[model samples]
Every structure is written in C-alpha cells, then in structure tokens.
Target: MDWSKTKTIFILAFLILDIYLAMEFFELQDKSDYAIIQEATIEERLAAEGIEYPDDLPDDINNSFYITAKSKDFTIEEVAKLKDQTIELPNVNFEEDQSFRTLNMILDKPFPLPDVNTESKITQFLNDNIISGELYHYWYTDEEMNSIICIQSYNSRTIFQSKDDHIGMVVLHLNEDNEIISYEQSMLEQIKEVEEKEAAITALKAIEALYNKNYLSSNSQVVKIEYGYYTHSPLSNQQILAPTWHLTVEKEDEESEDFYVNALEGDVLQLTE
Candidate 1:
C-alpha cells in the first residue's frame, strides 16, 4: 500500500464516524427538549382553563401489577364461625361448587360505633364485632344510603369504592340511631398479582385524560389524587382489578364527585355511582 494514500484514507474514515455521532447526539437532544416543552405546555393550558391539580403531583413514574381475584366463595362450615349475626348468602352453591360469594348479615344487637373520633373507634368495632372484619378498612359514610362503608384491603392499598355494589365493599346499614344494624359484604379472594410490575402513567397524565374526555369542567379543583385498585365490574362473580388513579374533583358550587382514571390504559373510567 502507498503510505501517503493509506494515511489519508484512515483520516477520512474517522472524520465520517465523528459526523455520524454528532448527528445522533443532536437528534436525542432535540427529543429531550421537545418532551420538556410538551410538559410545560400542559401545565400552562391547565392553568388557562382554571383547573387546579396538586402541586406535589408525583414526579416519579410508579410501577404496579395487574391483579385477578375471585368473588368470596365459602362453605357453610367456614361461614358458621360468624356469630351474633343472621347470615344470608346471595349466590350460594355457585355452579354446584358448594361455595357462596356474597355475605349479608343482620346483627342480633346494635354494635356500638360512635360518630366521634371514628377513625379509631370504628376500627375497634370492626375487629370486635364483624367476622373477618380485620381485613376491612373504613372508607366513608354514605349519608344518602344511611350506611357506613368499608372496603377490603391488601398490601396496604384499599380498593376504592367507585360504585354502590362494589365487589370488595361492605355496605353497613345504619338504624335510626346511626348504630351498626346490618351489612352486606362481598370479598375478592385469591388475589394474584400478574408477573413483573410495569411503569404506570403519571398522575398528571391521568388528570389530563379526564380533561381530554371533558370530564373536568372549568374552575374545577382536583382536591385529591391517590393510587389504588379499582374494578369496573360491579356485579361480576370474578373480576380483574387494575391500578387506578382516584381523583376527587370539585367544581364551584357543586358537590365533589369521585372520578377514576385507569393508570395503565390512561383512560377515564366511565364508572357510575
């Protein structure tokens, strides 16, 4: 090989490689800048519409698993352990499996659940009075139905109530004295988390989903946003629970309502009360 020609060829090859790397770096930088711009625009747009979300919206993208569960199926022997309450099974002997799903109970005497400092007081009543109630957590009082609502929990997350007959909720009917009279409980047993957890859509993305769907009106205040499991099947015997973003929105002069956004799908769940 001619020494002068070989040196020139080597220099040309390195020059071409340097040019290619420079182009790749610029392209990546442009994408990063575009993403930041898009994020800022969304914040400004929400402000223009007078919609408010939490300033401390989680910056980290969370990971979660999709779960599957069965309706509470029990045998007469298992349910016989419940005492001081009249028990009724709605879906008994499901498919000749000799198992029941729903549990309706009327207390023999009113269980004392006071209205004051109920955070601790109600917890006490549940562990002492209700059977297997240790698994249930106080959700909220439904004044419209005159009931104290509780939801089943797992892994430190309680299934949020999106509908009246939620499969994981216990609807406790209150008598005239606001005491525990009776309740209907449905549980999701054998909950199995699907394989590896995947990154979930951000809370900001969830809120934007609602706004895109026209669920958020102007002057709407997003009071709270929480991550949990919520199901769309209110009456299904078996259900799939997905990670969800539960948002509490309040419009001016309007009562606050709960809205859910599927964290995985990034769509507003058109769930009903």
Candidate 2:
C-alpha cells in the first residue's frame, strides 16, 4: 500500500462529500424560506409594502348585485347658463380634442384671476367666464393658487372616501399673476340618469384579480382602491364616463400601476397613460 496515493484518495472523497452536503443544505433552506413566504396572509403582504388594511371594506361582496349611481352630465340649460356669463377675452382660440371631448382654449392675453380666497376666485371664474354646476367640486390648488386649478365631478352616493378618486378631467392653467392662460374643459352635451348601475366589486377582490392575472407582483401592496368614473369612448367624439373601480398597487420600490375595472359591467377597461 502506497501511503501517498492513499492520502490523495481520502482527500478527494472528503471534498466530494462536503460539496454534496452544501448543495443539500441550500436546497432545504430555499424551500423553507418559500414555505414561510407562501404562508403569509394578505395583511402581512400589504404590510410588507407599507399599506394598511382598509377599514370600510364590505364583509362579503357580490359581483352580481347592482348599486345606483349618477353619471356626470350637463344639460342644454346648463350650457346656455355657462355661455350666458358673457366671458370676455380678446383673440381667444378654441380647439377641440376629439378623443376626450374637451375644448382646449388658448388665450392671446391672459386674464387676471382675483386676488381673493381660492373658493371665491373659483366661484367668480365659473360664474364670470366658465360654467357653474353642482357636479363640479374644487379638487386641488397649489400653494400660490395661481398655477393650476383642478375641478372634478362628485355625487353623494358614489364618491369614494379616497384621495385617488378625485382626479378630474377639468383643469385650468394660469400665469404668475393668477390669470387664465389656458384651460381644458370636458364638454358633456346632455344629462341622462343611469337607472341600472351595477354594484362594483370590492377593492380586495380587485387586488386579487390583478394578482391572479400576474398584473400585480406578490411583493407589491394595495395602496388605493376607489370608486371613480373612467372615460370611455365608443367612437370618435362619442365619449362616455363609466363607473369604475380604480386600483393603485405598488411594490416596495414604489413602482405602481393603475387599473380600472368597469363597476357596472365587471370588465377591465384598457387605459392609456
């Protein structure tokens, strides 16, 4: 028996054993970690993304049931009332966006907004130059209150108790002197009541749907889910505001995606940013 050859064989055998054991250890560890993660509850998952469970979630939501809600609309009388304000602007140009049914106005000379309170300014502007309606609510204004003014539609029954639900299609852009430089207004031609508004699915259910469809990451959290109106176009210049469930889901890195689910029909509406 050569002692040197015997020592080499022993060394090789020990190295192989060590490598096999290390591989087995890692495989076991991986499975254990995955099992722990898979056992996490929805709350736990949401917590990981720094989101809290919503307090007003319904106990059990039925997809088939319906809820009555009103859509945003303006009547001929309302339009005439707005036009009756006798808005005066020299060399003002108007262009219509066919897709959104919004009239984009560009002013040759900016009109100075009132230096009074924001509410008063808004009221005066609507009464003096633009339309005034109960449906439009003051949504947002900057600290200076001169750069931008956002107004959204709201109804008592359908407005969700979430900030995300307040995004409006009506916007007013102003100059440094709080003057109206330009504005985009949604032109709704008629008013009609929707009697057959269907009940929307719950926010949690919407999140689950996104997760199951792989649209949401398991590492993501449900940030916001609110009832709102999504603009849908059936054809050119024919725009309809459909009741929708808007969801905002985010990952730990804060990357988020917006999803709109048709509340009445329970269908996902395709959106373009």
Candidate 3:
C-alpha cells in the first residue's frame, strides 16, 4: 500500500466534508437571522402581555399561502335574536339600520372623554348596553388625544392570535370626556363548533402570501398577527364571519396598514367603507 497516497486521499475527503458542513452552517445562520428579525418587531398593542410564539415556524421564510375550505354558518333569525336581548343605552339617541340589522347610536352633542380610559369602564358600558357584549372579548383601543375607540370581538375562546380577534362584530367609540359619542354593532346569532379547530395557513405563511402578492414591501415589518372574524358585506342580511388573520404591517415611515387574510382559505379579505 502507498502510505503517502492514502494520506493525501484522506485530506482531500476531509476538505470536501468541511466545505459541505460550512455550507449547511451558513444556511442555518441565514434562517436564524430571519427568525431574529421577525421576533424583534415591537408589539405596541397586545391582548395579553405574554403570547406564545408559534413553534411550527419554518427555518426558511418564503411567500406561500396554505388554504382550506372549512367554515361555520348561522341563520338570519338567530342573528336577529342575538340583538333582541341587547341592553339599551341610557340618555343616547339610537337608530336601527335595516342593512345588516345593526344598531347605530349617536349622541345629540359631543360629550367629553378622558384622554386615557379603563377597560372596566368600556366593558361596563358594553355590558350595560349590549346583550352580545358577554360573548365578545376586549381587543384593543385606538386613541387620539381627544377620542378613543374600544374594539371588542365575539367568541374569544377560539382565538388563535391576538391581533384583531377582539374586533369581531362590535366597536365602541368615545370622546376625551369619557362620553360615548356613538357605537356600531353587528351580531351573529350563534357560533357553532365545526369538527376542526386547526388553521391550514400558519401565521408566517399568511405573511408570506402577502409578501408574494406584493401586498407587503420588504421595508415593512409585521407588528401584529391575530386570529379573528371579518365580515365582507356588513350590509347583507346574511352576513358571514370569515375566520381571518389580521396582520398589521408597519412601513419605514412609521405608518401601518392592516392586511386581513382568510384563516381557513388564503384569500385577503378587504373591508369596504
């Protein structure tokens, strides 16, 4: 046997192995950088302080959307009855709109609301005036110096994410004086359990879907991802709450835009004003 030749062969084999391992290491590092960037996003608003990040995230991030066809349905009467048991607002002018069978209430004059408000005050107001309030969870508050908007959602138990889940079918609007200037509500008669509780598209996949479709720019960062229900036709008597993924993307300019994707299916649900 040629000892020198065998030693040279072994050296060459080890060099190839080292190159392969180095390539794998760089790939893993790239993935780690992506995950770190994703986790660094500051969550300005949250339903809960400590939210568990999804464990099933992929090592490589790309633009792909998972889709499914599962959904639950309810009847018009059931929805109407949900509103029938609502509590009337005191000292407020209220009118029921024919479309979506929603109640639109307005104050005769603008009342004062505090710059800062408490959840209990908001919940008490809803508990006092909305029968469907018990079913909804307090989601978030959008406040200007003079006004605050408290958002609530129905069926918080099934919420998979915190982003927009609580903005279900009802929204409460208030002024700086803590006065309820107006409120808008839409109620679903029932929330029936379907066989499956799983979502086909992971939160990361939904963001990828947006990025692939050019709905999100590379410079934008995702601030929040939540599980919720979104209504496309608010005026329709037969309104359906599509299980949705609400992704709030913050741009380089510090402005944010909300992209709502269907949780079951991968379609982006757009809200019409």
Candidate 4:
C-alpha cells in the first residue's frame, strides 16, 4: 500500500484545519469589536472624544432619546466617516426637566382669570386673520410665574404672549409631525377690538416675575424664524421634519439683557413671524 502518500495527505488536511480555525478566531474578534462600538450610547462615544451634549437636552435623556434626538440614517461609508469623530447626543436631561415642569404647570389648573380673556382675544385674532387651524391650550413655567399659557394653533403654530409689553410674545410653528419648525417674537399690535396690549403686559409680567424669583434666563433663544412651505423640504439634513427655527441664547449671565436674549446670535431659528 502507499502508506507514505496517505501520511502526506493527512498532514495537509491537519494544516488546512488549523488555518481555518485561526481564521475563524480572528473573524470573531473583529465582530466583537464592532459590537462594542455599536452598542455604545451616543453620549459615551462623544465623551470619549471630549465632547459634551448640548444643554437643551432633558435629563431623562440618560435613559431615552428626545423626540427629536433619533439617530440620523447614514450609509455605511457615511457612518464610517464618524469612526474617529465624536458624535454628541442631544442633551436630554435639561429637556426632560423643562418638559416636566411645563406640562405640570399647564395641566395643574385652568387658565388664569386674565388669561381667559386673552384666550378669547387670541381666538378672535385667529378667526379674523383667516388662520385655519385648531386652537389648544399649552402651559409652561416661565421665569416669573409657575404657569404661562400659550395658544397652540394645532397643526400650525403656538403663540405665547406676555401680559406686559416687556417680554413680547413668541409664536412657534409646528410641522405636520407636531415638531417645532420655527418661532418668532412679535410685539403686541394695537388692535382696536382685541386690546391685546394689556394682556401681553400681564403675560410678560408673570414671566418676568418667574424669572426674577427663579433666576431663570433664556437658555436658548430663537434668533431667526423661518417657515418651510409644503413645497419646500421640512426636514433638515439631519432628517428632522418638524418645523424648524434657529435660536441663539447666552449660555451664561443672568443680569445681562444681552444674556440669553432670543434670536440674538442668529443661530437659534424658528418659524417666520
């Protein structure tokens, strides 16, 4: 029999098996590395590169993504571009706190006495202006008061005015997705029928009081407000389709009127006025 030839064949078979096992081990190691990267939170990944999340993020973000914080869809090559770049997740903690406080204030009680009349004014204004949309109540805590009322022009825009003339009013536009698209500050116009000036003053004073008491200043202010028409793209490059507004605010300083001023930096944007 050809014993030597058989022995040579056996040796080749053993060598091939060893090579295959080694290749398998290396492949598994590569997979493990990929898994570790994929499972990491965006914050963790960003922190590795010394980046911090934006302050607007709510605290609850530690456990969840904000409504607008979903990951952008990226191709494999596009994502690969981020391999060495740190990506910061939207800060969710601050946002959660803001949302909690805002929701609590509005849902806690009915509209204030003065606000009832203001609501009527708002309704009439909408009707007269031929603005088509549903109106709802939105409440939030401002610098001076525990609750501030805003008229949500459903599937449209929301308007929050100060009873006083100081702070003015903010108009926030929402997209079909109910996400903020843009916001703007408008001075109360002298309307013969509505007399919104007084109402705006009151709302403003309430907010100012809240601010003085709590040292609440603007965290982010909408600098430029722009609206996306149905004919235009609602979503930004990030694929966020909510109405968009640019905001600019002072991160530091409580006393400076310039501090935390809305729409000052030309960055924070919102819907058109």
Candidate 5:
C-alpha cells in the first residue's frame, strides 16, 4: 500500500465526519436554547408575584394566560374551583323563532305593501283604543329592502271585571318597502312608572315556578335578579319586562352549581341546568 495515499484518504473521511457531527450538535444546541428561553420567560412572568399558571392551559393560551395572570389573587385551586362552579348551558333552548319558515317568508318576497299603509293601520289601531305613546320606524335588508313601523305606548290601563292592569308596550313591523308584516301587544297594563323593585318581584315569582318544575333545583338560591323591557317585532307590541335570575344550586357530588334562568308566563325561556 502507498502510505501517503492511504493517510490522505483517512484524513479526508475524518474531516467529513467531524463536519457532520458539528452541524448536528449545533442544531440540537439551538433547539435546546430556544426551549430554555421560552420556559424561562414563562416562569419569570408567572413567578413575578407568586402567581400560579393553569396546569391544563387552553389552546388559546395568550388570552387564557392573560386572564389568569391578571387574576393573580386567585390560587390555582381557587381558579379550579371557580371553573367548576361555572355553569354550562346544555339544556337551554336558545333557538328564537324555531320555525325558520316564518322568518323566511318575510325575507323572500319584496315587501307586500307601502310602509304608509302599514304604519297608518297601526297608528289608527292605537289611536282608536286611546293607546298613548310614540311610534318609531325600522328597516331590514333581505334580498330586498324590508321595513318595520312600530308604535310604542308608554303607560296605559284597561279594566277586566274590575281588575286593573298596566299595558306598557305595543310594536308593529313593516317590510322593506314599508309594508305591514306583523304586530305585537304587551300584556302588562296601566303601568304608572317602570320600577326595578316591581319588575324584580314579578321576575322572581315567574322564575320560581320554572325552577320548581324542571329548569332548576327546588333548593336553588337566587343570587341575583334583574328585570327590564325587551322589544321584539314579529311578536307583539305589548312588551314585558324580561326578568333574568342567577342561581346557585348544590349538586349530588357536593359541587357548587351556577346558572342563569329566564322566566316568563310560568315557562322557562333560557335555563342552564
């Protein structure tokens, strides 16, 4: 064998191997350093005030982390407990106007008649009945223009067998071209002034029936209750103050349960059970 030739070949092979190993080592080192920096940044931020980050972080970590970090006063266990207490709206019927056909009809055709005709009918109806209030107009866009002409009567009264009740709202809907589509009348009668206390009491009673029936536990505690007016066209002008109630109930496993309940006419509208 030629010693020089053999030595040269071995040296070149060793150099090539060394270069490959160096590249691999640098790649691994770069990856390790990147991971360390990321970890250190997270730890430093979380440990600044002894704040504990959530163990099972959500995929959207930036938003969740911000919320958790801002609520540093809460411990990890406290946050877990809070999460457990949050109620899921699994049984709520959130579908408003479940009959899509009704909605589709209004959207499909050009508004049937002129807005003036529909508005006049509504105004005359209110005036003849001596319903005192303001009238407003609204428009919606489907494939074509749709309009809603509304008449809202503030406070009024009626007598049914010597019983006096408050009537608070009246609404009318007109199509895009100002054609009458629908009207709604509220059942509350002769309301003098809309007071929160009166509305809350009404809401509580309405909610209680639903709670006892199927929406909530009989022993559920009503933590908060609020009531206010809600207007919906294609329904009635008689707007009722919708009452919302927040409740906490005890589960069989001793977990605290939280949920919201909307009660109207002895029926639960939206309930998280």
Candidate 6:
C-alpha cells in the first residue's frame, strides 16, 4: 500500500468538502442581505410618498383559514324574549331549514342615548335587550343611515361586512334625538373553519400591497387596521370567507375610505354582487 498516496487523497477530499460548504454559507448570507435591502427600500419609498401608518405595525405571522357558514334563522321562540319591541322576521324560512339573514325591530318607546360615553350605554342595551348579544362587538355608526352598527364575532375574531352586504351584523336605528327607533340584525351560523391553517401576511406587507396596487391614496393617513374575515362567495348558500386585512385611510376634509386586502395572497379585495 502507498501510505503517502492514501494520505494525499484524504486531504484532497476534505479540501473539496470545505470549499463546497463555504460556498453554500456565502449564498445564504447573500440571500438574507437581499431580503433586508428589499424591506428597507419599501420603508424609504413609503416615507418619500408621505404615506403615514402607525409606528407599531405588526410583523407577527399568524395562521388562519377559509371558513364556511350560513345565515342563522330566528325562531318565534327567540323573538318572544324581546319585552319592549315590535319585531319582524321577513327572511325566515320556517318550513324547512328555518334559516334567515335579517331581523327587524322597532322599540315600543324611544330609548334615549346619552351624548357622552355612549359606548357603555350601548353595550348595556345590547345585553339587556338583544338575543345572542354576547357574540357581537360595537363597530361604527353610519350617519347617513342614521344607524349604529355592531359586528358579530367568533373566537375573538370579527366577521367583516361591506356597506352593500349585511351579514353577521346588527343595525340599530337612531332618530335625530339620539333615541332608538327601528333596527335590523343579521347573523351567521354553522361556522366551520374549513381549510388548513395557512400563513398570513404581516401588517406591513399588507400596507405595501395596497400601495403597490394603487389602492392607497397619496398623503393619506392609515387611521385604522383590523384583522378579520370577509365572504369571498357572496352568492353561495354556504359562504366561504377569507382572512382579510381591513385598512381605513383618512385625508383632511375627505371622507374616510376602507380597503380590504386578502391576507394570504396580498390582493386588494372588493365585494361583488
């Protein structure tokens, strides 16, 4: 056996292995650097355009999925609980599935709401007067409609609704005197999280997506950001909802506008009939 030749062969093999590993390490480092550069570039560009967002933008990755649910039906037994309201359920299918999408009510006497700190008053009213009120959270008031909107939620997450579509919500009508008048409610039932839990984009990424799509206006301030679900299948009987990012932008002397972005795909979403 040639002892010297064997030793030389072993050294050559180890030398080749070391070179390969070093090259792999450098490649990974380069890729990481490129990612950081790309993110920094986005930040700089946004500043240049005068687009303002909150300083505490979330970068945490979360898991979510597509869900399926149907509108809930209101039974005669449920409405019987209301003590001081004239009730109507025009959308109920009593014969078969007993499913409904809307509930209407008119207060027997106008209930006055206070001018200051009306939030606690509203919460008390819901618990005392409405059915399944625990499942909903206060949303916003629509001055044009003269209504106060409360959104239905599940598992600490809210179900989003557009102006055109009324699902999983309660609309409380208010008269000029800040008194309760008539109202309508909609709800969802049999909510099943269907697809596998998938990764969702962060708040920053969603904002970037809106800017890239030209859905965001220049010199606008993002006043609100919310994580919720939106129905992608509006016409289907069993609707499928997607995890969404809702961004509200406000400009001086302009009406605030909402833009929803699909969290998984980074696409700006709009509701269709």
Strongest candidate by TM-score: 6
lDDT of 4 by residue, 150-260 (tens): 433213332222233212233433333332223322221121121121111222222222233432333522122222101012222221222222122223442222112
State the lDDT of candidate 1 residue by residue for 1-273, as single tens digits: 799999999999999999999999999999999999987787788899999999998654467877887878656676667778877655556456565566678889987766688768778877876657788888878888888888888786777765456677777888888788888777778888985788889888898898888988899999988888887765467677888888989987777878888888887886566
Model 5: residue 108 alpha-carbon error in angstroms: 25
Instruction: List, in order, the clash count of every candidate structure.
Output: 0, 2, 13, 47, 26, 0
- Rank by lDDT, highest first: 6, 1, 2, 3, 5, 4
TM per candidate comes to 0.78, 0.51, 0.52, 0.28, 0.20, 0.80
Predicted candidate 6 versus true structure: per-residue lDDT over 113-190, tens digit per residue: 899889788888888888888788789988888889888887877888864577788888998999988778878889
Can you give the lDDT of residue 185 in candidate 1?
74
lDDT of each: 0.79, 0.54, 0.53, 0.30, 0.35, 0.80
Which segments of candidate 3 are over 4 A away from where they belong? 1-100, 105-117, 137-152, 157-176, 193-198, 270-273
Q: Could you say which candidate leads in lDDT?
A: 6
* Span of ten consecutive residues with least summed lDDT in model 4: 100-109
The residue ranges of model 5 lying beyond 4 angstroms of the native Cα positions read 1-130, 135-176, 179-187, 192-242, 245-273
TM-score of 4: 0.28
Error of 6 at 235 (Å): 3.1
Candidate 3 lDDT score at position 171: 60
Error of 3 at 29 (Å): 22
lDDT of 4 at 86: 26
How many Å off is the CA of 228 in candidate 2?
Answer: 2.7
The candidate with the higher lDDT, 1 or 4, is 1
RMSD for all candidates, in order, please: 6.3, 12.2, 10.4, 23.1, 25.4, 6.0
The TM-score that candidate 6 achieves is 0.80
For model 2, the run of ten residues with the poorest summed lDDT: 157-166
